[model samples]
Target: MSATQFFKISLKRSTIGLAPDYRAAARTLGLHRSHQTVYRPADSTTAGLILKLKELVKVENVASIPTSVEINAARKAARGYQVVEKQGAFTKI
Candidate 1:
């Protein structure tokens, strides 16, 4: 079987002050806030919506949808420092 693809759509801009149609399109795409992302199958309906809100969103073609754990990991910040050693327990002399 062929592998299915998905569209990684992210709201790069806010919809405030925009036309009602544009707002509706974003809402329909499950985007409620800026920087929020949603995955949808790569299809014509999704393409039309993306075209309508192309200026407000960023779209990328992904091979597959990511799991919640993977998504969270991608959003997590990296720790810059490494732990070289642990503190030893102190004893009274």
Candidate 2:
């Protein structure tokens, strides 16, 4: 099967109070907030976007684009019971 192509990009820095050009670049690349993960095609234009936002974003190569289900699964997995056990009542306690 043809492997699904995907590019993983994350916003590492805040665009607030930055130069207009830099902010525009980040916005153009669809990175409007911190810790934002955007999936893009594997191409030179995408690469250029990443480069432009490198100071404010991180670029990574991923196997494929993760769906909402996958993202939710990962978020669920990261919810440590011990960490938030005291914050809320247990559902099946």
Candidate 3:
């Protein structure tokens, strides 16, 4: 069987001050806030909605959907420190 494709849609701009239709389109795509990302099937209906909000969103074609863990990892901040080496008890700084 062939793998399903998805549209990785991220809201790059806010819908505020825009037409109600644009805001509704964003909501229909599950985007409630800026920078929020959502995955939807690559179909005509979704395509139309995306096209309507194209100016306010960023779209990418992904082969598969990401798991919650993967999504969380992507959104997680980098660790501030890295361990270079471990010191032995007899070693002096």
- Residue 57 lDDT in model 2? 78
- RMSD per candidate (Å) reads 6.6, 7.9, 5.1
Model 3 per-residue lDDT tens digits across residues 25-55:
9999999999999999999999999999989
Q: Which pairs clash in the backbone of model 2?
A: none
Best by TM-score: 1
Query: Which candidate wins on lDDT?
Result: 1
Query: In terms of TM-score, how similar is model 2 to the real structure?
Result: 0.72
Local error of candidate 3 at 63, Å? 0.8
Give the CA lDDT, 0 to 100, for residue 49 in model 2: 74
lDDT of candidate model 2 versus the reference = 0.79
Using lDDT as the measure, name the better of candidate 2 and candidate 3.
Answer: 3
Task: Name the runs in model 3 displaced over 4 angstroms.
Answer: 1-4, 76-93
lDDT for each of the candidates? 0.93, 0.79, 0.92
